[model samples]
Target chain A: MPDNPQVVLKITDLVKSFDSTKVLKGINLTVGHREVTVIIGPSGCGKSTLLRCLNGLEPIDSGQIELNGQLITAPGTNWSAIRQKIGMVFQNYELFPHLNVIDNILLGPVKVQGRPRQEAIIDAQSWLDRVGLKDRALSFPRQLSGGQKQRVAIVRALCMSPQIMLFDEVTASLDPEMVREVLDVMLNLAKGGLTMLIVTHEMAFARAVADRIIFMDDGHIVETAQPEAFFNNPETERARRFLNIFQFQELERRRA
Target chain B: MFMKAAWLTVSLAFWGLILSLIIGFFCALVRFWRWPVVARLAGIYIELARNTPLMIQLFFLYYGLPRVGLLLEGRTCAIVGLAFLGGGYMAEAFRGGFSAISRSQIEAGLSIGLRRFQLLRYVIFPQAVAVALPAITATAIFLIKETSVFSIVALPDLMYVAKDLLKEGHNNESNLLLVLSYLLIILPVSLFFGRLEKRVRFAGFGD
Candidate 1:
């Protein structure tokens, strides 16, 4: 898979530790061009850590990460430039409260990337339109519902024209109904051939959207398979137990 | 003469506050960035400013410094003392505001490829200033009140005029006038800050 010409992101022997506690232990993963790889695991299992490491949010202890064939983990790497290529939507929306929906989206493009304001605004509007938030250009974050804020966050990332997008449980904070709207936007992105590395607890959404599924536990990649295969015929005992919790609860509900 | 004194008092307070804001913001940035050696120096300055009275600091600047041939004029000493005192409070206010910005916000800014300075400029500052506004306003009011002590340096301030009028044996009238002058200065300022705070809240900043 490393030799595949379509690979856009390559992580090799990736290790991360937090104050003497190892969070990621020598993990190797590859995500190809337009591939949607969804990482699923129980809480505290380094799923989020891996995404953080990829985005340069958290520093890696050892190993290397190559994005579009450039070694990103090397010292003196220009993260500001590299980060422009990697867009991330957070679980908490994290929209700038000071700016309106459109301003928030245009900030990175206009201010950071030094693009013209009018051009950036046009691009931002198109992104907002795609996410069904075109009318919310002037609305502030406090003025929007949780789902709308999350969608604005997605639009904010898209305006930068990132090569890859990272979704770190983007729908995790939304209300049940709100989750569907955010997930739908992501589903469209996945289907439209955006290279995405998603960490999610939405088992069904993960199965539906992921081209490949990665099951991680205790800082190790336990299993990697196609979504349907991983969901139906998990190889590891740990993954089986992990999936059974959701399945068993459904079974209990049916029996009742 | 009395009007001149009142103008001096307002002018001194205004300039002192401006100086303190610059000093405080710079020191807070140093401490926040944890720049070794210099951050320790900022910490020490904050402690010394916070612990000492403005009167003592003024006395040192006006009288004591002359002993070392580092003489400063009375008005200059008063302004320096006010800035020294006010800077510490402003720094703490700024630090509180900066900390209120969560890790995720910075991460979001970084993910958008913001440089560190850009992060501070775009994301961190606008919200932090909103959260720190009330405290900064309080500091401004306190700095204005501290202008009363500038009389000790014999710079013609509101309190200096009052004390001179007492020497002329017009006690109650002078005392009444002093109280009225302070009321005039403080009232409008308080009302203005209140309105500003409300506007920011209404505009939905700091949330």
Candidate 2:
């Protein structure tokens, strides 16, 4: 890790609730400019809700989120501008089924950013080539495989040149075989030093790529540590139990 | 005389459908936005149009309103009445289309920096049109049939001509001509809409 790393996102005492049920409770964290922070938790732990709040998709009850020193959670903030800096890829790969690969990638740039369509197309083609889907430029989402669709979704976000990207279980809805292809793209982006925050259940990928792992439970951050320390020597009982489930699953796979 | 009335009916149906679609689209948007006072007003309009019979609505506009100095020609009254009725049903159809869209789709649009109107235009409307086309076509057909009811208000539509011909001792010929004229007008229009529906049907992502 580099000394004096620039912090790109800072969260302080963030709280969110839905109908008296608190989802994210007093979360505090800072993400470095090029850090890959992976959040792991059980279902309903507010991992997705936290990511959603960062993008202003979900309103917060209290606290503030600062993106690159800008108050993103402030009242009446122009979220559209903030969102252009912070891109998100959902679990379901919400590609517009009506649009082809190139069109989907060009939508944000050409339509939202007012970039020249031809220029955006050329850029989008390069991104598709990088993902090895250049030939699929004209292919609609339904025509593509799950892995292909997810790759296009990543490129769609990348085309915007966002300062940070949030991926919420992007590979969760993919088939077992398709997961590796999407993970490879994420790994490539990580190697390229793109700032990312991911919520995922893939423990091996987390261990390999995460600069830090944040373990959450019951809408609270139970522990935050480097992957090596967190995996080998969990500091709390909750962390240990959570890791055990992964370990048990791994052992069962080995036996099988 | 029969041909003249048939042309009048066709023209009335065309104008009535155009007005209905425009009114319905905006009404649907109002409800979708869910503004407090305007949404309730739109709700009341839709309810009134849907619950009351078209004849009474026509009579109120053409006859009843004259007492309040809001007089309109018979043709204008008929078109306006039919449009109001069709708009209510069309609003529901468009609302159904809007509701069928997944929230994630809108989230994706917003996440990529699309403003509300841009999101509606590029992402939401295309998909909603796909879902709503069949219903809209059906409503158009209903609206065309509804124009026949305007004859009761002496608008000189096809039915009015047929009634006059029957009273002049040409009952069999007039009834046959009436049925054929309706079939001739409706069949081609229905087919055109059917083809439009097919062309716009979305090839949705795998189930």
Candidate 3:
């Protein structure tokens, strides 16, 4: 990596533990500008933990995490400076239930960026329209469907205009029928050249949109390849087994 | 005769309900924010007000706190007593609301770069209010009926006022006036809150 390369995020030897159990064991990852990296792993494999650490939602036991070449994982790192450039979307919608759709979208820009109210509102309305939720501007989170709530979450993050966006299984909590609509919005964002790091179980979508697909197990990167090479020719036995299990689960779900 | 007494019952309830709500909400906030020694002191006040009988609490405040150097009139003492008692319950109400909200909501706020104060104002507080609304409304009604305790304090509130008129005008005159006063005060209040509850439900205050 150069002193100031085009890479938007860099994680080197990131480690995290809880009591006696270690979750992320010396993982190295990097995300580049205008690129989408999808991480896939079985349950309890620390993929979500990695995503959480990137956003400072979970503290890393030891690691060096840098966003846009600025160190963010040190004990005395400037969080406000780093966080202002990153946006994250969680599995659950996590929308503020009390706020109307428009208020939820407008909150980040106005409060954090200290943008003038009128300017923030204009940006929020544009993002709301982008998510195809202009009509729901006055509606509350409870009034929307699971897919609608997730879309609102995306629009809310986009309202801040982050340089990097992180998605942690955003579709995991949605109804099966509702996943596609949410994914459609993500695909559009990716096409527009937004830099994103996604943790997803949807291999088909990952293959369709992700530039690089990384597979992990027990906190180590098992393999990193282009989506075609990783999905078609997994180099390791662990990757092969994990792919088989995911395929079997998808088959069972479809049959049922 | 029952109808006339019902009216008297209603009016006194109204005075109690409104006054307690104001007291309860602020006290709940004091407990929630954990203001240094104030939180523990609020806890002590709640225990004293709750463990003892309401009637006794009214008597103590109307007759007691004054001798200790705090002088308050009859009605003031009664209102203060109701507020003190209601505040204890309100603390629990607000705490329940606070715990009900998930951490993910706050995380979302932080992810968007909102500072601590901004997160609480824009996210946590609004959701907490929504979560606490049901318990708050129920407590409000409870406080209203509890106003009858003020009679023991000799406050000129609805119940005590009705009682005074009853004592002076004899059975026929006092009965009708008591009933009328209660019907005028309590019924309207209950009706108002009942409608508000439905609005909160229909408006979908809490998700």
Candidate 4:
């Protein structure tokens, strides 16, 4: 998999610790070009930690993460340059509050990438229109709904034209009705062949969108399988136990 | 004569506020960015200015400096004194605003590939300024009041004329005029800050 030219991200023995607690314990994974990889796990299971580490938000104890055939975990790696290629969407949809929708979307492309303002705006307008938010381009972040903000955030990341996108529970904070709009965007992106590494609790959405679903627990990936097989028949007892208790199915199992 | 004295007070407060804003903004930036040598220097300056009385600061600038052969005009001393005292408060107000920004905001800026300097220029600064405006307004008003100490340097400011009038027979009229003179000076400043605050708030900054 490491030798495969199609692979966009490769992680080997990724380990991360915070003050003494080992949040990510020696994990290995690879994501292929345009593949939608979804990570699902219980709270504090290091799913979020893994995504953060991948995006260079946290320092790892000892490991290697290669993106697009470059070893990014090496010291002296230009993280700012690397981050442009790896777009990330936080759960909170941390939009720039002072900026209007168009400004927030154009900030990276124009300022960081040094693209001309007119050119960046043209691209931003296209993405906003794609997200069904072109009319609200003049609105500030505070003026948008949670779902709208999340969509705008997605558009902002997409404007960067990143090699891969990392989503860390992008819909976790939204109301139930708002969740679908965000999930629908992710599904559309998946269909559009964008490489994505997502950490989510939305099992149904995960099953629907992921080309491969990774189940993690206790700071490790316990199982990796196709959605249909993993859902219908989990291989390990841990996977089976997790799949049982993860949702309303747990109560049904107990009742049966 | 009273109008001239009040004008003197207004000019001192106005120039002093300008100098202090410049000094305090740079000090706050130096401290907020944690620039190695300057951060410590700014910290010591803030502590010294805040702990000591403005009168002592004026006396040191006006009188003590002459002993060291560094003489300055009385008006210079007054303006410099107010700047020295008020700068510390403004730096603190700015720091308070910087701290109020969430860690996520910084992270979001970094995520967008903004360099450290660019992050400050684009993200941290505008938000911090917005958050700091109210505190800055209070500091400006306080500095205007601190101009009362300018008379200690014998600057012939409003307070000096008020004291000068005390020696004469016109006690009630002098004191009342002194009080009104201050009102005339401070009221416009207070109103100006109020207008500025409304402008920033309307533009949707700080919160």
Best candidate, DockQ: 1
| Ten contiguous residues minimizing lDDT sum, candidate 3 chain A | A1-10
Docking quality category of candidate 2 according to DockQ thresholds: medium
**Tens-digit lDDT track for model 4 on A1-256?**
1123598999999999999899889899999998999999889999999988987888889999999899999999899999999999999999988888999998899999999999999999988887788899999888889999999999998998999999999999999899999999889998998999999988889899988989999889999999899989988898887777875665675798
| Per-residue lDDT over A1-256 for candidate 1, one digit per residue giving the tens place of the 0 to 100 score | 1223577999999999999999999899998998889999989999999999998999999999999999999999999999999999999999988888888898899988999999998888888889998898999899999999999998888889999999999988888889999999999998888889999988989999988999999999999999888998999999999999988877896999
lDDT of 4 by residue, B106-196 (tens): 8888888888988998888878877888899899989988888888888898889888889877799998988887787778878988887
List fnat per candidate, in order.
0.82, 0.84, 0.64, 0.59
Candidate 2 lDDT score at position A177: 99
Give lDDT per model, in order.
Answer: 0.90, 0.91, 0.79, 0.89
Which prediction has more favorable lDDT, 1 or 4? 1
Per residue, candidate 1 scores C-alpha lDDT tens digits across B128-170 of 7778888989999988998999988878899988899999999
For model 2, state the Cα shift of residue B58 in Å.
Answer: 0.8
**For every candidate, what is the interface RMSD in angstroms?**
1.6, 1.7, 2.1, 1.6
Give the least accurate 10-residue stretch of model 2 chain B, judged by summed lDDT.
B198-207
Better of 2 and 4 by lDDT: 2
> Per-residue lDDT for A128 in model 2?
89
Model 3 regions more than 4 Å off: A1-4, A75-82, A253-256, B1-23, B26-45, B66-70, B205-207
Q: What tens digits encode model 3's per-residue C-alpha lDDT throughout A56-106?
A: 888889989988888888788666556778888999989887678888888
The DockQ-derived docking category for candidate 1 is medium
Q: On residues A6-80, what C-alpha lDDT tens digit does candidate 2 reach at each position?
A: 889999999999989999999999999989999998889999999999999999999989998988887789988
Query: After best superposition, candidate 2 residue A97: deviation in angstroms?
Result: 1.7
Q: Which of the two candidates, 3 or 4, achieves a greater TM-score against the reference? A: 4
TM-score values for chain B across all models: 0.95, 0.96, 0.73, 0.91
